[model samples]
Target: MEYNPQSKQEPLDTESEDRFASEQPSEFQQPYQYQEMKQDFKHSGPGIASFVISMVTVLGYVIAFVVVGAMATSVFDQSGNLLASASEVIITIGISVLILSALNVIGVVVGIVGLALRNRRKVFGIIGTIINGVIVLLFMMLISTVFVNAGGL
Candidate 1:
């Protein structure tokens, strides 16, 4: 093309192409679209459901511990065979389940805390997620043990 500076239109050459691609707006040209997303109880982040669920898990563990503690105290009352009696077995199983349940509750609490502090620190979020996973595993293990003890094995 011939030189046409006065034409008031620039040529679409390589330079213009590069400049166009490289150009960026000082701020976003379009505002960020704010959309409310539908969330499920399982998928919700550190929201009400998480808090409620964590508390529920903790409550469940506490209940189990209380029951086990009472049962353990009762076990010693029954005399005779000190090794393997129904009461002793019950106490042992109960204690084990209670411990696992407590750990699971702790994991849920950590996960909830992580979700709460996700905005402040990503590490907290990750830790919370890990804890939550651990809790789930613990719960699963607890269930499996119960089943095995119940003769489901």
Candidate 2:
């Protein structure tokens, strides 16, 4: 028997040639594609520096809270009434620190998401950085207010 390659007609109503060409996997689909890693297209967005600064600002507030609490506790322990009555200052600082930490955590979460989804929208990373700055400023104001009030100014 003789081989007949063109004896059968291809399915109609479509571009079978294009479909067949596309269906065939090329060199790009090889397993080695995984080994050939590629970096993100946008590398200059809000990066490690912004992340570090944001974290440091958040941590500064937390450290301030601890330090202020320690000082207030020691004063109360040593003094009979005058220093102990200054508890309001410490309480305000602690609450402010807690609020700032929560906001910074939110900023970090947003930054991570922005970094992950940068392919979809490039501005998200910048937005995350802005959010972090806002968090830092809010905390700064709170701490400054405590200082002013405590100093009787």
| Worst window of 10 by summed lDDT in candidate 1 | 40-49
Model 1, 36-104: lDDT tens per residue? Answer: 543311333544334444456656666766776776654553464444345665766667666656655
Write one digit per residue (lDDT tens) for candidate 2, span 1-153.
244354356544368568755766787775334543235355434444446556666687768777777666655544366474576766777676676666576666656666665444445456557768688667679779989999995
What does each candidate score in C-alpha RMSD? 11.0, 11.3
Tell me how candidate 1 scores on lDDT: 0.57
Model 2 whole-model lDDT (C-alpha atoms): 0.62
